[model samples]
Target: MSFFTRKKQQNSSDASLVLASLGGDRDAFCIIVARYQSLLCSVAYSSVGDVKHSEDIAQETFVEAWKKLETLQDPEKLKSWLCGILRFKVSRYRRKAASQPIEGAEDITEGEDHEAGQIGLEESAIREQEQALLWQTLEQIPANYREPLVLFYREHHSVAHVASALDLSEEVVKQRLSRGRKLLEKAMVTFVEDTLAKSAPSLAFTTSVIAAINLASPPVQAATLGAGAAKAGSLLKWTGLVTLLAAFSGVISAFFGVRAGLAQSRTQRERRSVIVLTSLFFIFAIIFVAGMFGFKHLAAQHIVSPTLLAVISQLWVLGFVFSYLWLTMYLLQKTRNLRAQERIFNPDAFTHPADSPSAKQREFKSNASLFGVPLFHFRFGTPEKNDGPVVGWVAGGDRAYGLLFAWGGIAVAPISVGIVAVGGLSIGAVGIGVLGIGTVGIGFVGFGAAALGYKAYASMSAMGWESAFSGGFSIAKDAAIGSYAFAQQVNNEQAADIVQLALFGQGYLWLLGTIAALVIVPAAWHSREVRRRMKR
Candidate 1:
C-alpha cells in the first residue's frame, strides 16, 4: 500500500481500538492513551508553562474522555475532542491567574524547575544539559509565541486544529507561527551573543548547545499529518445540520403569527398595525438577503481582492467598535429606566436589601440633578409595581426581528437554488426536492407553533380569564386573611397581561419564525406585507 493509504488504515485501526476500549476493554484504552499521552502532555505543558501541571492536566483530560466516551459519536475525532478539553482547562487556569496578584519571574522559573525534576532524567549528562538549555530558551519567549510554536512543533497539529484550540482563525494561527519562529531565532542569537560576551568557560559547550537546539527544532510542515481533511468535512456536515434546524424553527414561529393576525376581527387600528409591521419586515428582509448574496458572490469570485479584503477587515473592526458603543447605550437606557421606576415608587427607599446589615449601614447619597431629576441615588427599594401587562406589547415588534428573518431567507435562498441547479430532472433530484421541501415545511411548522403560543396569551388577556381565576382562588382561602384589605393577590387579568408581555417581549424571535413560515405558511406574513405595501 502507498504511504498515505497505510497512514489512513493505521488511523482507522486506532479509532477501532478506542471504540473497543469504550466497550469495556481496558487494555485497548491503555494502548490508545500510551500512543497519545506524550503529545497531550506537550500541549498541556506549553499551555500551563509547568511540566507537572501539564501532566496533571493531561491525566484529568484522559479521565474526562473516559467519562464522556459514550458521547463520542466518532472515535476518529478523539484528537480534536481531547485538545478542546485541554484548551478549556488552560483557559480556566489563565482566568484564575488573572484574578490573583502577579508573581515575579524568579518564582515562575523555580516552579518550572521543580516540576521538570518530577520527570526523572537518567539520560547522558551532556544530553540532559542540552535539554535544560533548550527549556530555558523556551521560557524566555513570550507566552503567545511559545504556546503556538510548541503546539505546532511538539504536538504536530494542523493550523486548523491549533486555531480551534486557541479560538482563533486559521489565518491568525499561520501569522502567529510565522512571527513566533522569527522571535525564537532572534532569542537564540541573543543568547549566543550574551554567552560570547561573558567569555564563560563553557563557551564551546554553549556553541554546541545552540547548534543542537536548532537541529532538533521541528520543521514547519504545510498541513497536519493524516485525517485533517476528514475532520473538516465532518465539521462542515454538522454546520449544515445546525443551519437546517435553525431554518425550520424560524418558519414554525411565523406561521402562528399570521394565522392570529388573520383571525382578528376587521378592526381598522388592528389591521393597520399588522399591515405596517409586516410590510416593513418584508422590505428589510429582502434588502438583507440581497446584501448577503452580493457579499458571497464577491467572496467566491476573488472580487474581494487584497485591497478589498483590507477594506472589509477595517469595516469589520469598525462595526465591532460601533456595536460596543450601541450596547453601552442600550445598557445605559435600561439603567435609567430602572432608576426612574425606583424614584417613582419610593423616593426614600433603602439603599440595600433589608437582609444586609452591612449595606444598610452605608448612608444613602443622592447626586446632582439632570433635567430636574437626580442622575444617581444610593437609596434603593423595591421598584414601582408596574400596572401594565407582565410582558411588553411590543416584545417582538423590533425591526431587528424582521432583519433576522430577511437574513435567514437569504441563507435558505442559496440552498434552494443549489438544490434546483444540481438536481434538475435526475433520479436523485426527487430526493433533493423532497429534502428542500421538508426542510422549509418544518420551518413553517415551528413558526406556527410560536405564533399559536403568542395568540393564546393575547386571547386569554382580552377575555379576562386571568381576573376570573384570581377571584375564584381568593374565595377558597381563609375568610379572615382573605377579607383583610392588606391581603393582595394577582388577578387573572394581571396574570394574562404578564404572559402577553413575555410573549411579545422577544420580537426578534418572530423573525426567526417568519423565515420558517416562508415554506410552511400558505403565504408568509412578511411576503404578504411586501406585496400590500408595493401596491401603495
Candidate 2:
C-alpha cells in the first residue's frame, strides 16, 4: 500500500501517487498537489486573466481532485483529469462572477485614504493598475497560444515542462509561446512574463491544499445517509405523519358524526350542530396547516429563526392532535346519545342491492371485482354512494378507497391520487404518503411545488431535514440546492449527488431505472384493465 516514501513520492508515477493516496498516504497526495499546482494556476490564469483568482481556482481544483480521486479510472491520465476539474471550476466561477455586481476599485480603497496609510494606498493602486493592464493584454492572446506562454513562464521558462503539462511537443510549446509574445505589446511582453513567473504558486500553495484536504470532511464513501442526517430525516417524516394522521382521523370522525345525525330520531338542531362541528373542524385543520406553511416560508426567508420554526412545528402537531382528540370525543358522546333514542335508523339505509337506485344514479360507478376486492371502482364524491363507502382494488371518485390504486377528489390506497391524497405512493394537489407528489407534498421522498420530506425536490419551496433541492428556496440539515438555500453542504450539484447517494446507495441510477421499470410496467397493465372496464 505504501508505494513510495515521502522523498520518493515527489518523483513517483501518477498511478503510484494515486494508489498511495487512496491507501491513506497524505504525503503522496501532497506530492500530487505540489507537482500540478503551477500547471493548474497557469491554465486558470489563461482563462480568468487574474493571478489571485487563478490561484484560488487552482486550490479549489486540488480539493475537488482529492475528493474525486477514486473516480479516475485511468490514473496514468491524472493530469488530464485535474485539468478537466480545473476547467469545470473556472466555468462555475465565471457563472457566479457574472451573477454578482462588480464593485468599483474606489470601494476597496475608500477606508485606506488616511495620511498614515498613503504609501500603502499608492503601492496598492499601482499594483492593481499593472494587474488590470496585464489582464487586458493577456485577453488579446488566443487561449491555445496564451496557455503555453503562461505555463512556460510559470514553470520556470521550461518549454519541456509546459509541453508535458499541456500534452504537446516541446517544439509546439515554443511555437505558441513565440506567437503569444508577438500578440502582446512590446512593453507588456516583459511585464507579463515577469508577473506570471513571480506569481507561480509557491510551496505555501501545496501546504494550504494539504491543510484544506485534511481539515475538510471526508468524502462520502459507500455509505447510507449520515447518522445525524438520517435521524433528522426521520424526525421530519414522523412530524408530518402525525399531523396527517390527525387530519385524517378528524375528517373521518366528522364525516361519520354528521352521517349519524341524519337518523330520523335526531332533532333538526342536533343535525345542524353536527354540520357546524364538521365545518369548524375543517376550518381549524386548514388554519393549522396553513399557519405552519406560512411560518416555514418566513423561516426560509430568515424573517423567523429556524429554532422558532422547529418549536412551532412541534406545537402544531400537539395542537392538532389535541384538537382532533377533543373533536373525536365530542362526536363519540353525541353518537352515544343519538343511539340511545328509540326512533333509530331508517330500515332502507341498511338495504343496498348491487343495482341499487343510488348506485345507478352515481356520476360514474364501476365495480369490476377481482377476488374479493373490486379491480376498478369509479364514482363521484364523499356523499353517500351505494348507501355506503366505495371500496375497490383500483378505485376513483370524489372520494376513493382501493386495495391497490385510487384517484379522485380524496383518495386513499397503496397508490392514491386526488385533490387531497394519502397512501404509500400518493399524488394530488395535497399529498401525504411514503412517496408523495403534488402542489404541497410531504413524505419520505417528496416532489412538488412546495414539499417537505427526507429527500425533497420542489419547484418553488422545499424543506428537507436531510436534503432539499428547490428552484426558489430550500432549507436542509445536510445538503441543499436552490436560489436561496441554507444547509451544511450547499454546492448545488454535489448536494444533489449526495441526496441520490443517500436514497439509493452507490449505483443509484441503476436502482432508480430498475424501480421505474418495475413501477411503470405494472402500472401500464393496470391502466389497460381500467380502460377495458371503462369500454364496457
Number of the top candidate by lDDT? 2
Q: Which tens-of-lDDT digit does each residue in 1-536 have in candidate 2?
A: 12222465466677656644543345567888988898999899889877767888999999887776656666678899899999999998878776763542343345336422757866767766777888899899899998998888777788888889999998988888888888889988789878777778888888889889876642222112224222122222322333344345335433443443343212454456557766765776577567666765665456766555655654554465456546644654553354333124443332433213344433344546678776666542123312344578877543569899776445788887654678998765467899876556679987655678998766445678898765445668998654345677652234545555234333434533433332333334333432333221
Candidate lDDT scores, in order, read 0.36, 0.61
Please report how far candidate 1 places residue 223 from its true position, in Å. Answer: 28
lDDT of 1: 0.36
Q: What residue runs in model 2 are displaced by over 4 Å at the alpha carbon?
A: 1-4, 103-119, 218-536
Error of 1 at 402 (Å): 69
Residue 130 lDDT (model 1)? 48
lDDT for each residue of candidate 1 in 9-118, tens digit (9 for 90 to 100): 24544454443333223334444565556556667766655544566667666666665555555565677777788779878776776676365345555655664676
| Best candidate according to TM-score | 2
